[model samples]
Target: MNDIVDLFVIGGGVNGTGIARDAAGRGLGVTLAELGDLAQATSSASSKLIHGGLRYLEFYEFRLVRESLQEREKLLAAMPHIAWPMRFVLPHHSGLRPDWMLRSGLFLYDRLGGRGLPGTKRINLRSHPAGALLKPSFRTGFEYSDAWVDDARLVVLNARDAEMRGATILTRAKVVSTTRHAAHWDVEVERDGRIHTHRARKLVNAAGPWAGKLSETTGDPHRLRLVRGSHIVLPRLPGHDQPYILQGGDGRIVFVIPYEDDFTLVGTTEAEHHGSASEAVCSPEEKAYLVDFVNDYFAHPISTDDIVWTYSGVRPLIESEGSARSASRDYQLAYDDDGAPLLTVLGGKLTTFRKLAESALERLGYGGQWTARAPLPGGTFDRRQGVAMIGRWMEAHPFLTEAWARRLLRSYGTEAETILGNAATAEDLGQDFGATLSEAEVRFLMRHEYARTAEDVVWRRTKLGLRLDAGQVAALDAFMAEARGEAAAAE
Candidate 1:
């Protein structure tokens, strides 16, 4: 009776952490348990855009697109370091949708979000800088605005903010089972090979692709259409900062986004995933599909050999009768209060996570909406100050390379000072695990960001995996293992 939490959230993806942060900020006692590291699942595996799903306009999902557009702007203003605007170039394809239809869609997209972002405009691809990489066949294209985000970092920042607001965030923890009592629910969590029980006034299941399986514990027929979306990272395409929205002839759209400064991210194929969501991966066919799709638009064709890294994530869309490509990206909140309140999030997009959280809390009867204006951790600075902040950091730490300083600032924002601490030189930052990744940053992640393993650091917390060799990865793994051992011995 004494150890009761007001809200217990399962899953550490954007939705779960977003809900926990919102609830905790509103003075509700919250506990969030993640089966693995934060964002280790579908959250980090996203295409890394805080976009409005412009293509959804074709599917007549006006509400979803409009809300996502609004959320995109809100997130950019709140966390400029991790989320910023990027223009998408949609080349004209005479064989597919007509140019007029494309223009009409862009027009609706521009007007739908209340004109906060740059309006969509036609571009002469033959003359623009973006044209240089594209084929001559793309004589004309339209450019529209959308925001890009560090998806994994978004999850971590939300979880961190929630903790600061007094929510207990447990990584490497799983809710083994739940039992509804008369007025509350008993949640059994397995952490570090030990089981602990806690009571909660309400329980939230934001388990992404695993929502269906987790809902089985409640004896509900929670069906989800598991769709696998995969991405491939390649060496930077020689061109502008703008990304591309490639329309495949097969009625699917693919995105070629600029990623991590030196890479271009190309992705997202829609295929029904049948097995465990955890086992989802970019199949060879998916890779070929993406490569072929992108090759259609770019003058320089990309093959599977050009791919630097590939990742796949399962999307748990609400089950409906349609092809995977036509499935709705809109989210659904199912509430059951026959006993204690139980909220299960069915499907959602990364861009509208905050909105989704607000809805979830409202459904749970938590009072007031408080997250709309609040900035995420280290995100209190004005959006215009992102570049200035980096410059200031570089000026203060003259020992850091411009590239290194920028990377740190972009990743940690104002908190970069905390990570850099009093280090006077690169050597003071501790062992270099290659690609500018040092023990200092690794320790910062481990201590503050719930990074527990080398893969967590390289793959999720940072994209240094794209640059580090296998030997360097092994070195990092050994270093982290030793560091954990030392921490354990000290304890």
Candidate 2:
């Protein structure tokens, strides 16, 4: 925190980390400060889809869709472990738009990225295996492509890659204030009750929902619209593998995607978020609404008791007059001049952070002057490389359980082995913190993933929160308390 950095970034969500990664890859001396654990805010609470916001097609966001579509494949190729493909099946309903209209949209979805993925196909719901979980009334459906992303890990990976490129990342360090001088910006960050100041030639506010608030810290009163989206995790349906997209009686579309190895994720009510982002949570009414919607169409019924977990996020949409669902997910970036420059990002989705970062940098005057083949840490594996690496690693470590190995592969790609490093046996994994969590893995996350607390591990670094027991959760918190103290002691 001594040397003046070329770029100082606020927020550790996907946007800030992504911009840091890109800037560092371009050889910029960058430093990023996160007030809380990385992605603990809105980033980790997302529905975790890296799609082109298929429903946005209704609002004629073709340009945004096209860019997101292009990013889908690029992201999948970059981090197959954390970002991969999933197909969403939309069942045709009598009241909704016709099949022909859906088909046309699917066709566009196919071509949006110039064939980054296969085109959509019509599904004979009754005949296809995917339809077995649906009610008898549903006979036809449309299947389209999209990628599922590990939102929090995506942010961590970007931060990791940035660190590898010499960007200093400080987690649990909140930016208390930003003051602009004639030539540079002075940032004061508070960590463990201690205040530390850093100087940067340029500052970027990539604070996700808090972007506007951070702008105020720099004395720029930018406006932002906060739209809340909530998702519920329920017991998985029997034989549910592929994801399903259901149209509500209302115009909104809901996703019932296969989640962790044991559960299913259904959700998302988009409401105008009119209050603090810190208080965002799935409301009682939204829970009932989602359950009712799912039971209406699915063969299996779900009740509130079946919901194991729930999360909500405030999407910082560019304010518009229409309903929250109709609001644009497209991002807005602005910078001020007067010698010291500050860049701000308004709205962004999990899928489009990379593209968003590129655009923000361009506006910050890095356009055309630089280019990068930058990949997130552990993302050196292209799709083909990832599989080969996973197979080879598993083969060499035959003692490792297939389930454990597979989970690690999907979570960390080739870097999974790096996390498992020299462990010779399952017992070497240390105390079983429940689920597949081991003391080794927990320590690895603390060392590599920028995790500061149990929430950082269970909620963000891993989705084990959905599986850990109450006692296990307590134990993890105990360990986290010690690790956090250790982290502070180091400084």
Candidate 3:
């Protein structure tokens, strides 16, 4: 391991990876260490929508809205395969809010974002197909723009880009201690039961929910509010590819987004969490609450039995004086009095990760004004025109299965060809799992995406765990164990 680095970032969530990518692009020597798999925390458990936070307008968060809006469009074009556009239908319950007010909100959302995604459109609930699943009491609604992101993939792609730009990304590596040595920080990274130390001119605590704890390690007095957000997945809603944003009776917004091909994701409950971020679990109460909220707004209600999976994430909110929901989602960047130059990132949303990272790098005095036009990994291709590249890759590998080819194209874009190389058939990709997962793809992820553990491979690199059975996971685990042994012997 390199003992000298320009910047050391704690946390492997969206913010940390984004900062690493941005800083690396600006020619800074960077290293990012994560105690667990990337996105194992809040990054993967997001509502998975990238928008301007239209609801934020009511709170008068104009700056957040505008920044998020711009970032949304930039990220959509930057990583089209893992992220794409989706329209959201806001169904108005006549018994609740009026259509004009909803229309006004949509108007603000449309204009606030100069995003190319089409503006708001009024819809007749009785005539629109989206209305068929809604309660009869809802007769009017509006459809507007937003984007759905494969949240985990976003982190992995960013990490990959940073590595390509010469940043060292170490997953399953914990930063257990740090000491200030005059103008720099001596950071300790623990991996494989060994402690590796490095010196960084600047350190960033972008550990999301763990930011507060990381600050304590450096002996900073700042504390953060760890709020838990939970989500539930249910059997797919018929023809529910587009997402729906509904206003809960409690005046909060709950998202019912189309999930994997056969599931609908509904979430999230916000409550003060006083637990470990890595061990956060979705409580039965949260699942029930989400199911009830969705059922109240829809004709086809989902119950506990309908649930497929549930996940919970801790939002490291900057402690303030109000309800956790009202607690500001605005991020804070700090340089404590220690002079060791630690930048602690607090309170950020998935939509603004790229911008949040850019700001973090600027604060560290590394980039100053560079990387405004930088692209993420595989982002060199015009993402909006990704289909053409997919066509070319498919044409080149005619013997490959469509499902397998599409999986690579959508997840890695044109970079999939690099993995495919001269392979001409399924045999070229090696052993196949029940899903499109293959030995070739797994090796590529392990070599390029910092996938060191089964969780990283199964959960982050691919969502195959949701589709694979327990037995399949066991097999993958055994395979990983053997691979780890071989890797250790080689070293």
Residue 166 alpha-carbon offset, candidate 2, angstroms: 0.8
| Per-residue alpha-carbon lDDT of candidate 3 for residues 423-473, written as tens digits (9 for 90 to 100) | 778678887766777778877887788776667777778777778888877
Candidate scoring better on lDDT of 1 and 2: 1
The lDDT of model 3 is 0.82
Best by TM-score: 1
lDDT of 2 at 38: 89
TM-score of each: 0.98, 0.96, 0.96
Error of 1 at 439 (Å): 1.4
TM-score for predicted model 2 compared with the true structure: 0.96
In order, the Cα lDDT scores of the candidates are 0.90, 0.84, 0.82
What residue pairs clash in candidate 3, if any at all? none
> What's the distance in Å from true for residue 129, model 1?
0.9
Candidate 1 C-alpha lDDT tens digits along 76-110? 87887787788889999989999999999999989
Q: Which stretches of candidate 1 lie over 4 Å from their true place?
A: none
| Model 2 stretches with alpha carbons more than 4 Å out | 367-373, 385-391, 484-491
**Index of the highest-lDDT prediction:** 1
